[model samples]
Target: MASERIDLLIIGAGPAGMSAAVEARRHGLEVLVLDEQPSPGGQIYRNIRESDPQRLAILGDDYSAGRRLADEFIASGARYVPGAAVWQVGEQCQVHYLLEGRSVVVQARRLLIATGAFERPMPIPGWTLPGVMSAGAGQILLKSAALLPAGPVVLAGCGPLLYLLAVQYLKAGIQLSALVDTAEHRDILQAWRHIPKALLGWRDLLKGLSLLAKLRLAKLPHYRGARALRIEGAECAEAFCFSSGGKVHRLPTNLVLLHQGVVPNTQISWSLRMRHQWSDAQLCWRADRDQWGETSLAGVFIAGDGGAIGGALAAREQGRLVALAVASQLQRLDGARRDHLAREPQGALARCLAARPLIDALYRPQAENRIPHNEVIVCRCEEVTAGQVRADVRFGCLGPSQAKTFNRCGMGPCQGRLCGLSVTEVIAEQRQVSPSVVGYYRVRPPLKPITLAQLASQSNHDLSPETP
Candidate 1:
């Protein structure tokens, strides 16, 4: 079959994608949105439509705000296809996705990638253990299934999300064992310079402070400046061990939720061979995108956390900005009209992102956590340890792609999503060079796994001769 064609195609239904879809529809653009989730809200607002009143109360207003965006998106008349896993994107704006066990293709004049961020890997010892998972996963369980850990849970690591989840769990009456904060005092000190500007986004700063206040009210054990984290267990995670304030502490817990912060999900961008730069502030690779979210590649755009580590509000504004840019590019709106339309969202985006410097500085992952111990498992899919990566680097393996040949690190089922940052940092540390110099994995196409049958089923007309 000939590929379904549209004026604009958006991947992901998060705040960015949803907002972009709504704005594009207003400009009389034929927009189609494809998402991997079963629901409209991305991870931030997952299941917002189906969430009960009590659950909404527990999750708080920031999450509930997504409902308005979702409703707007639905009412905007954009075609939305959920549960569509886009595996490959071509340079010509052709997208191949798997839906209901069939591979389908679509081509668009313009494409928007709003697939948001993922938590940075905290590759401490025994991180791959059964009972240890990211704090984001725990939030997902609570959001989607209304499930919490059965026994004592220890939320370890540093970030605003760590305390936010703790407060949410407290509201749900799930008592946490302790919070092992990996952030150092120096982090706050480093962030002090950004405080004046961060105040422009005072509501966020207040929300963070409020979350901490609630945790204090509950009298939860908050271990500050924690370091040298290790999960101890023979089979599953039994205890979390860490050092703080010149003393070692071991907390017996069945569940350990780890998080430092989130980084842009640049898998698709990298796979497309788009230019990327290592962000020293956020400590991750960010795709090079213009003010309106268009990337190094023409006709393709990135919005939300997929382009950078902006929060939900910033992402929503970014989506609107990209929509304006796309509308202008398609001549649906003149450049002057588009600029006039974009003014509000541009201001909003600035306001939303004003506090990021403070947040990034305050929660920067320590070198020890970023560059794990030699024995720690960095690549969980291939069971590649940091020691192996370092040994390979010492043997003259230059970068992540070279390390991939030395050992099957990024050649895993997840395609370096889980291990890319860790490997880059490890090689950079070993070589005494910057992460930008060491570089990230050379991401190729077939971004996600697809069956041979799925490929065979696609019509000849849908296949592209040119590789992305």
Candidate 2:
């Protein structure tokens, strides 16, 4: 197996990792970044193909800036490896990973995980149909490939993303059948306390408000109290049925772009045995980090959504902060210099988080199943149906881990990476506890895969005089 060492090993190539690498290299640290995709951009604001840069301006500048940083990371002498799926990570200062179908070990003085997040799914009857997808997934296809699904699309669910997609559809010149969600007056009321935090930064607040204004102008079919109960179709999605105050609503559409919200991508970090905190606002779990981005394990750091759902802006700021801390620890920078480098962006991210306090309040776990009577696939990896999960619970297994042991819902190639959020809701509903009370998940170690030779070689290093 190939083996190498670096001053820092960054386990993602998205905004957080890119940002961290750029700043760290400036302060004189050797950085290596690994990503599963062929290129650098992550799900949000991924690069779109266009003959002209002016054409890319159609989506927004988020992609433009990411492109610049990605290019810089490639040019800055920091090692960049794409098409590498990093499965296991640990606190023992070694990484077991796969590259071109072979296992390799990377020994790092320090490690930073910026492995981003995935969309949260809310299951319903026809959701298993060919057309239903997380809103983020839909946008990734459009943003990355400039492709749009056929026929009318329904943008349902909640959060800023719902409206963001509605606006994107309007810009892409696609007519939306209906934009639906269940938002009570209490949803906004619960969010009010968060406004002051968000209002601290005018630019960030203004940007979010601008997106809302665009949604208002688009004049698409939007429902506040509407809740999708089921999707009805024989082979594919033809229409969806929803309810509000005893009144049933059936929105006719061919595609359903749905997502409850986004949760932190914690699988890689969890596999390293990092402590995870359940963010009630995010309705998902994230790894814990100190102000400087250090995890519970020494030499392992985290930034971006892996630490918290601070969005792209927060993720970017955290990158700068982590870079400074890491450089200082490795002696390329100093404490005062590190603090100075982090001050401005850290304050700005905090202001941004405070400005949209309501965003977090909007994503709390669902109290009811929010699913339909028919079978809706929750764990796509295991092909586990909602009925099967309920059957397992009926047999007395509760909680996601236990439920996984019973029905094998979250155990698959993706592990629980894709369906964890949905399964959490199912577990909470069965246990009749707030999803918060159900608590977040715990990641077992050996976060990435390792080879037998690498393991044996590592253990017997001192036994062989010629090994080094």
Candidate 3:
């Protein structure tokens, strides 16, 4: 019922949002941050302050880095609203959200979205089975609850996260049946061209290599050049099968963990109707933005994986840059002052992203791997199959939006978050055009679901004398 206004409103309190708040507070900006999680740290560094000592050591320094940022943000005196689910972000900077089943509205002079990223679509037969989950989902379980999958877990897919999860499993003394890596020999061969540049991030490369080395030394089963992966079971995932090194192999397992990579969580950005472009390397749509994370909208900005797939280091640096830009725009900081403050963080962001091209090339998923087979489910929310999507395409649906009209591929509760990319790829393949031309869904708010009762309550509250 009460509408609060602030100089700056940031959605998400992850690395980018926290860092931005800290820097912006230094400039004396009245800043507020809204985060959906019960605590700070987002996904990458979830539960840092409360993590068990033994678990912290097992998770390693990459995660530990978040503790400093979180602590600084907490002490920075910025107002933070945790466990608030943002529903609508209007173009004019009107923010509508739900907190504890109560509707809250806030208007701000400027807004920043740092919602971060989610696991890429990795659809295959029987993926909707109960025992099958994304690697990120499994990682969340570990990070939030200190939980690990039961033995004979089959991790099928390839990416840095896959290896990271494997290392965590090892550290937790969890057993794995095998790692079915889809990175083929040709991808590594192609990645060699970028090795010189990749060396700039030698620390990351070494860390990655060390994880693999540990996996090898552990004598854990690993399969390379894996393809045609699918899960099988009547009710839940009972086994996994894939082709590796020209041989078809199947493993009896109850848990099938999958990871391809991550793409920016673009739901809010898309709902805001920001300009977006498809990235060939990461195989996703990225919101168009300037170096300071300003989107096409006048006073709206995006930082972190919400804008693109840069990791935490880039996100933190970018957040600082955005804070400076926002301050400058508000005339709190002069243009020259903004430029001077931005210099170091800009360089840091560049260095952090130097090896991204090589890493992206090395793990770029295969084209077939992206577009699901006809029988495979594309939209889990609607239970829409790839075949259904292709059929819609053949019936003159040229893009995800058009396909959604004929088939409810993106109309479910997820609002196309999980199925948007797959739907685009399928439409493009069927239309014999590029995915870029096929375009993505026209995302609208509410970004997350809310009850009609809440809407009615908001309306009634707005008309009441208590509202200001």
Candidate 4:
């Protein structure tokens, strides 16, 4: 009944986790990868393995590219357990996860967290309405179920994803009512300085431009420099409203998709009480990581969007780098050998990230959108409003942890996954301080919800480590 143990335990099966597993196996390290998804690809390439040819064509090559990585990981001899919901990670490299309605524990010599990123919450008024969801959710439907919005749909917010999803939807014969862009002329101006470095990532720039060109060719109603977004409906979203060029426009639509960008999913790191720094450019908290992706704690490392907002390509390279570092640490590879093995991935990682500053600058979420109005719901789980958070700030709620006590802001089922960034920004705006000063929610486990039966099912022997 002793728990399983391995040389390395990875908690995600995204680009980073998959790539790390393949590389670790090459170095003859015993690796085990546990992912909550039923498949290997993370959000960026979700459901790639089972995707049909037509679905792959509609999703584009970038998504289809994950098939190769997933295949390699499957063949790499590393142990992969799908549908494992990891809830608690112990400081001693012990991980507790639920599988098949039962709790299981595992120990590792090293732990790699590649949980990846999620879309930043867009907390405009009526976002909690039934017909409104993040653009990422829309993409998920398309990728996983081959489903498209059936009614009049409006895509709003900034970032390359908005355009990319629009193009995909267009290719799938779904006509969007309009595309309301929240990026302003000033954002473009701010991004200009990063253009030179971004050129090093010319391929990404060209891909972005291609997506834009397709949108223009489709003659989609594209609104630029939009602000003051509001989704109006009595019980569900009916119309998307925004202001652009000093004029307010409201488009009648049954579905409203909103996105600013993605930020690292650092919930696991936060639960571990690792040091995190606020990212001004990305507008989220990032777990501190070294060049090799090791976190502030030894034997624990993070890579991909979980550590920073690098795209999939960067995440793949980071995964390899982290694996190499782990191998060297485990004495499977000497220092010189590790460095030699890391050269290609390191260069590739740099190239992938060269354009990030420009993208971050260009798609920085508007202050109004991030801070939200007093009436707008910021925490969907607890139905906490910006006004409530602001009032709590006035009543001496200094940080997200305090706000939780005052109004249950981050105490909901999501464990502050959706509302953490918004709550921190709202409190900071209310207190006239930086988000770093306001800080984030003090995260704990169970990282995901668990049932009493699951906990009871774990016998003491299963929870105990085997004696050497």
Candidate 5:
């Protein structure tokens, strides 16, 4: 097998990875970045294009920086390998990536994982219909591709993201039938306690308020304390059934945008045998990392949402932090330089933690019996169900771990993130243990789908039959 060594191999090309790649290259390191998408901006900073020069002009220079940075890095000899899906990371810093359907392996002196995040699937009845997607999906359509649905869409979820997406839809000449906020009032009130720590700036809060006003001024129906009852559709989403303010009702809309916040992307970190833990704040497993983005293992680091959910600005700072640490490891910088890079990241992380989202993460739409009684699938990859797991419990399965063994309920491609919390209910009910006790079962590696070729490459290492 051939080998290529880069000083830094960033597994993602999002805001965090982009920043790290730029910083590492500036500090005289050979940097390579790969992304699943065509562009470099992660979820938060959607890579802007000149598809519509007017739209580009409207988005302003602030949003246009991603393209500039991506271009500059590419021009500066930073290899930006887009549309490559990184499948695995080995203990020896070997990365298996499948690009254009061919598996390749490369070793990195140091690895910085900034794999970013994905929307937490908060399942209710009929979420599997054709028109249903995450709020982030809707935002990506407008912000990245300038696409919009052809029918009246319903935006349902909490947090600033919901509103931000709704406004984007409205801006793109699409109309939202209604905007539903499932965030609890007490939770929002309780989040106020963290305001002192979050006093760095009110810009985040102001952005939230701006999005809210944009949705309201667009004359869309807005609902707080709302809940989705069910979505009715056969081939596509015909309409949505939900409740709000103690009133059960049905709203007719062709599309439903769903979100329950986000969880970090720890698939690479986990597959590399890095240590991780459940973040009650985000309600998903996140890689454990230090202030400098160093993971449990040496010569490997985690930055951005792959470690925690601090959004785009925080991710940029984290990328710099990781770059500084990687620079130190390469003997190009000192301890003071590393600390200087981290000062901003730490402050940003503290602010995001003290923001309203932490309080919102306390209740993430999954509890025992919270599964709606209807046609939506929880584990989309497996097509399992609440009824199926409930039946497994009825047939004498002890807990979620056992239920997984018995019925493959939580053993899908997502590794139970989508349905684990839901399955915990059945486990606790059947085993009579605390839901937290049945908390997650043992989490394993390759959390996402990987190719056989990629796995084989790592396991097939041969060192030339030495001494023969």
Candidate 6:
């Protein structure tokens, strides 16, 4: 098929994407949503439609809330395509994607990228080994397949997901060997500074406290202030090692789940040549946008964790807020009507965003952990090591773009998705500069990998001109 066109095209079906679609439908705007997942929910609420009842009960209310939003999105009548891998996004809202071995293109007046986020880069010794996986990856397995690790499991790292997964494992009646937290004592102390403002979103704070209470009641061998982690194994993970409170501890375990938190998935935004700024507190690059989520590119907007690391609640609110902007831009909603509709969601978004500073402060990954040891692999795609990148820096490769030429750090199948932030941090540390000065990788399309056949299959003709 040749390129298709629509009024509004959305690039994810997570909370943000779904919420935007639902609002766009009410305004009667022609819309389409594309997602890589086999189903509607993004990773956070994956497989909610087909989730087992037992598993749903085990996963808790946050997981269950997605089903209602997804149902509303389905009923809203916006066209939805699942299992679609978006590869390139071009001028005037032209998006190229691959679906089931076929390349497709669509043009729209506006594009909303709700690509969401991924687990923060957690590179350490033996991380590539089997049985050493991210806490988010483990949660997906449990969510999608009800699978749990066979042998004793050790949970390491900080953030709500780590504790949430730990709580879920306990609910599933799985025994854990230990829980090693990388959050330093000073993090908790610094986090207190935000507590006054964080109380504005008291429910979220209470939720974190509740997760902590559950983990404590389970009496798991909890190690606070843990650092210097090393995963040891011959062919697979066998033991987890870290230092805690001036003592070194090693626990025998088969599965080692690691997590630090999450950061925006910025491949699409960066490829669009949108401006980004370093978020000091969140410790990552975020898209520069206006009040209504519009990026530096006029018609392209970003919401959800893709724009910044606000959780699902914030994503949903921001989605609605963006849809209002789109509706007004399309002249489907008059100014008064748009303002009336946006009022509640705008406040909701602010409240949801209020807790982020405290959360980020409480769970910020240590600088040492962020860069890792010189020997540790930095780029999983090209197997580029921290040492190689530092060597590149020593040789006058001052930025990630230059370092990429020297070490091929970000030039791989994943296209710097997994290693961009880590590489930036490593380069900055070596050069004795701030990450903001070092800058992120320069991403280009095809944003994802596509075969030559897929490229050849794309239509030669241009998409129709934008609606005037």
**Whole-model lDDT per candidate:** 0.91, 0.72, 0.87, 0.91, 0.71, 0.90
Instruction: Evaluate residue 250 in candidate 5 and report its C-alpha lDDT on the 0 to 100 scale.
Output: 78
TM-score of candidate 2 on Cα atoms, chains taken together: 0.88
Ten-residue segment with the worst summed lDDT in candidate 4?
A: 459-468
Please give, for residues 1-468, the per-residue lDDT of candidate 2 as tens digits.
223337888888888888888888898787778888777766664653232464365566655666667677767677777777775676766666666666656777888888887776666666678888888888777776767767888877776677777776787788888877666667768867776665675665576679878877888766766654678889888887888766888878778988777777788776676677665556677677888889888878888887787787778788888888889998987788778778898887787566545667754435443432327787877878767767787788667787788878777766777667777766677677776666544556444445666445442111112221
Tell me the spans in candidate 1 whose CA falls farther than 4 Å from its real position: 1-5, 459-468
Q: For model 3, what is the C-alpha lDDT against the true structure? A: 0.87
TM-score of each: 0.97, 0.88, 0.96, 0.97, 0.86, 0.97
Counting clashing residue pairs in each candidate, in order, gives 0, 13, 0, 0, 1, 0
Task: Write down the lDDT that model 5 would get.
Answer: 0.71
Q: Against the correct fold, how does model 3 do in TM-score?
A: 0.96
Error of 2 at 67 (Å): 3.2
Model 2 misplacement above 4 A: 1-5, 48-51, 244-246, 363-366, 369-376, 385-395, 433-468
Q: Residue by residue across 212-314, what tens digits does model 3's lDDT show?
A: 8999998889998888888999999999998987799989998999989999999988888789999988899999998889999989999998888889999
In model 1, state the lDDT of residue 394: 85
